[model samples]
Target chain A: MTSEIRQFLFESLTVMKYSTADMDDDTVLGPAGADLESLALAELSLRVEDHFGVRFEEDEAEMFAAMTVGEFCAEVARRVQTASAT
Target chain B: MSRGVAVTGIGLVSPVGTVVEEVFDAVCAGRSALVRPPEGHALHGVVDVAAIGPAIDPESVIPPKDARVVDRSIVMAVRAAEDALADAAIEVGRDVDPYRVAIVLSGVGGLETLARQAVERSTRGRLGISPFMLPGVLPNMAAARVAIKFGVRGYTSSSGTACAAGGQSIGEAVRILRSGEADVVVCGCTEAPLFPTFADAFGNALALARGWADPTAASRPFDRRRNGFVLGEGAGVLVLERAEFARARGATVHAQVLGWGATSDGYHPTTPRPDGSSAAESMRLALRDAGLSTADIGYLNAHGTGTKAGDAAETMAIRGVYGDDMPPVSSTKGVTGHMLGASGVVEASIAIMALRKGVLPPTHNLDDPDPACDLDHVRGEPRTTDVAAVMSNSFGFGGHNVSVILGRAGG
Candidate 1:
């Protein structure tokens, strides 16, 4: 599951034209690192939700602000597990 | 006459060609770009024929991910904007003040995106609606995306006046420049109405050309046998700058935007006012705005959509304005078909080219002139004459009317 999330994130960022070579667990995803614009980030979120069959709540949307790619994957994985458990 | 607003550069993506010179040359040669849809085209049997051009690969202009969200119409606008800026030799952030450069793009809105999203939502439920849907489908996205891409911070606006939107956009840009709000304005229109749903709308309305054996002859404007317009899709953009500013920058002045006039018919929603009074008033206002008399005009690039009503009404309007001494006139729609919102700018650019090249573009396929449209119609062969001043007219659904005049730069 972790490997799938990482692959998805890498591919999504690549589609946004971000270099995926240096990205890893500690790599920032927002203002601190790739500096993805609002549209790009929204797109990334949508792609992740579509992949994992999970939904990002309104309150949890802002969680992407300072989140790194690794942190994003972990949160998404957690949501996927929760959805399946339900 | 007031010193004209300089048209420094023109960019066009039409059925004719992508480049201004290439399309203008095609226009002068009376080459028809209208073609039969390939087998299994969405609108192949539905519309019988159209003036569909080469498919635009959005990924070629923008990143694949970004292109996935933006409308194809906006992509066409971006291509034309790039060409226009390059032709003017003006770099927005470096050469010109980003805040002082404005944009006025107009179109048929984003019907393609709306249709796709609507279908998705209906089929897959609420979660299927993409977050990018609104931004992708808005008409103003054309202007917004151009500003975002080119860093144009000055006044930006989008007009949605159907076919008249293009002419209105250029006229509004001239107003903005005259008001001293912006030194340079990139103005034009883009339309991608070739989709199946959009084509059906026009087809159901009985507004599109039909039953033509040769698709190339589908759009025969001003011809006696003309039935209706051939639906087309493309964009046309022009770089309008103050005359002094353009001269200071040493830009190549294509022509001068001399005057603009807009009015409403208030007669019918789809059909034009048969009296042609309002359209004539629009042209008269354009002439009045330019401070010129009827005799000063040399040529007219007509909004001849080949519809029986539209062609006759426009002819009546011309007779009302020019009377017996009508100027040599033609309709390039015969070649490129009706581009809807983009038609206004495309025809305007062709008019400017006519002024610069001393050649009057012929109305292709106008082998037999309609008796009602009895004017000095340039047909068959292109007329090589020193055209100094020209007028381009665009009338849209809902009775919107606009006329713009262009003159030889410093002539």
Candidate 2:
């Protein structure tokens, strides 16, 4: 599950044109190197929606803030699983 | 603050041609550069691509390492800026102070590279993402990169007011110069949103023309059969300098930017106000800024995107602003299609050329003009007329309305 989450995160960053070579699960995403701008983040959200078939609450945007690749994937996976269970 | 700004140099990269000379010739001859997309692309009408000349090389303007970080839109802006600066004979690092130079670029779509990367990641997983994605995807990065490339250290900014971005950028640049923030301002817009997702979005909205096999006939602005606007990509740049500065430097002036006005409808996200109040107000304010009455203006470069609502709204706006004594108006979009954010600057440049050459280019493919659009649209061939002052209009999504007035150099 952790590896699956990591794979998802990797794919997300790749789509944003960020190099994921040095990125680990713990790598920070912010205004730093891996940080996506507001427009990019919005686009990323749409992609996530299309990929996972799960609708995220607009308030979850704050949760995305400062999230590392692994954390983002885990959150997405959690939401996806919860949505599926429902 | 009291003085006007002079357009010292102009550069254009459009469907008509890449360079200013080529574009000017095409404009004068009333040639259409709209072409049908390749099969299976799922686009309607014409798609205008950058007319890259064989003699010019992209590598000459941008190094390979730096070029990779930028999208096609940024590349077009840099290329146009280079041409304008060279044409003006402004000696960089010598006669010009880098600190006094500013860059204001307007665009709608930022780095489409990021969006494409997102798609790839969704299908192939995180391992497929590129390292340089973040820096390449930001909208402001284009202006930032242009400033770095040109060594401009002062007042670097960008505007993204949809299609009105270009006009607003130029107006802001002029204000910057007038306000003494910068002595020389490089103002323009570039956009290349021909990506799959963008096409899907526009197509889904029914904003793109469909079922038109012939490109030239697809973007028929003000014509009865006009279905929608064609998507186009290009850049147009103008060097705006204080009139006094231009005179002091003995630079050749193209035209005087007399006044500019911008406003928002606060109405719809995509559709403009049916009453055209906001658009008319912008034109009135622009005329007021120029200290000229509507009677002084000779021609108008319209923001005619070939859309049903847009065309009708703009027509109502023009009639409201100019009343029964409306000037001859034409939409270059008939030939160039809709250039999105770059359309404002491109059409403004065309207006400047018309003022200089004393010839108004016809609205190509407007064989049957709509009775609703009652303005005297120069049809078929270009017309020879003494144009003293001209008004250019650009209204964007989100109800952004911008108007700018330009006059002959001496006028």
Candidate 3:
């Protein structure tokens, strides 16, 4: 599931014309080549809400900065599953 | 050396048309490019297709690999620059020294791609982030891309001074050329803020016309019923050369960029000062820079976004600067909506066209003018007049105000 989410993110970035060749789990997202700016991030978040069926608070921007790609996918998968359980 | 910068070439991407001829024809014929949106996507008050132009074909301008790294704004900028170079009959590597060419582009928003990427990273993960995002999202990327395309090694910079970005960019280019930093400069602004986030943000601020059902009526600048401005996206670029250099090269000079003035309100983050002092000062300084008086200007291209505050403030500023001898004023926004950073350049092109053709385009959709905006707004049909000099105004968010003065060559 984590890999699946990572794939989804990667595909979306490709659609936005961002190069993904150098992106890795340890790559810095902020001030990096293809990292979305604050404005772009907000837009991407809304798209994710529709695609993943998960709602995220504004504070998630910080958490997003700290997590790796795999960790981010796990967190999203966990949230989606928890929401289904509810 | 004491004269104004020469306008040798112009490139525009507006709703009316992409090329200069198409836009000029549309304006001259009093044609409104606004249309009704097909089917369910209805915007209130604004026209459905206000001056929509052709899409930027990247293949025609840049290679596929390099084009992939650019956003909409950069694509528009490069295309316009290419067109301008062609229009000027300038062969980049042969006709002119690449080192003496400068590029100064302006924009309001950088890249919508970044906004989309952020959402993906937050929802999916950091591993999803692309490596090309930062370079793609920077404001200066448009200028950098243009330089790379043309092999221009001189000064390259970008300004994000909101709506005034276009005028300010052109003004800065003029200064650079005058100061001998570069013999020729390509200056303009591009904007592509059609993303949902931009719409929502402006909608939340009540800056956009709420009536999505009628995009045609959505943007009514200077109309008594006008509410707010309709969001727009496009680019306008101009080639500026030192007077002596242009004359020496036997270039066809369209008009002279006599002077430019830029100022900040220092009062509001998103609104103009009520008294219009800063806006007035900007125009005053521009006229002073040109060594001309109010009586010398024959036309005015107003930054009339149709917003209540914006129109009133601009009107007051014009009255303060020109006193009783106000020139014919028109807001092309009624036709092009508001291209944000590109508005100044687009309007400047219109002014130049007016000078070349000896006619002034009308302010469309201005049926019943607000009493506050009482200037002689060229309305209904294009007016025939021998325009010697024209003043174009552009004020943006953050209290940025810029004015440029262009005169007929040999004046």
Q: Per model, how much of the real contact set is kept?
A: 0.29, 0.00, 0.06
Q: How high is the lDDT of residue B185 in model 2? A: 89
Q: Candidate 2: RMSD over Cα atoms?
A: 8.0
Write model 1 residue lDDT over B1-411, tens digit each, in one string: 235589987888898998877888888887788877777766676677777756778887766667878887889998888889889989998878999999999997788899988898899776677778887888988888889888899999998789999999999999988888888999999998988899999988888888988998889988999989999989999999988788878888989999989999999899999989999999999999898888888999999999999999999999999986689999999889899989999999999988988889999999999999888999988899887899999999999999999999877
lDDT of 3 by residue, A14-80 (tens): 7655577888756544455346655445545555666788888877754566556666677778988
Q: Residues B1-411, candidate 3, lDDT per residue (tens digit)?
A: 645589998988887787776787776675656555334432333333333445677756766545665677878888888888888887667877998999999895455877878887898685456545766788888888888888888888998898999999999998999898888999999998766676667767878755545566666778888888877888999999998888889999999999989999999899888778999999999999999999999999999998889899999999999998899998888777788989899889989988888889888778899998878889888889998999999999999999999999777
Best by lDDT: 1
Name every residue pair that clashes in candidate 1.
none
TM-score of chain A of 3: 0.79
lDDT for each residue of candidate 2 in B1-411, tens digit (9 for 90 to 100) = 556799988877788886665676686676777766555443332233212222234456776545555567767778888777776667546757888888898786455787778888898775346545765676776677778777888788889898999999888987898898777888988887766667667767888766676767888788888888888888888888888877889999989999989989899999999888999999999999889999988889999998888888899999999997788899988788788888898899889988998888888888999987778888888889998999999999999999999999988
**Cα TM-score of candidate 1:** 0.95
List runs of model 2 lying over 4 Å from the truth.
A1-86, B39-58
**Considering every candidate listed, which one attains the maximal TM-score?**
1
**If both were scored by TM-score, which would come out higher, candidate 1 or candidate 3?**
1
RMSD, every candidate, angstroms = 2.0, 8.0, 7.6
Model 3 regions lying over 4 Å from their true place: A1-86, B36-51, B212-214
For each candidate, the alpha-carbon lDDT, in order, equals 0.88, 0.79, 0.81
Model 1 DockQ, alpha carbons vs. true complex: 0.41
**Count: clashes, candidate 1:** 0
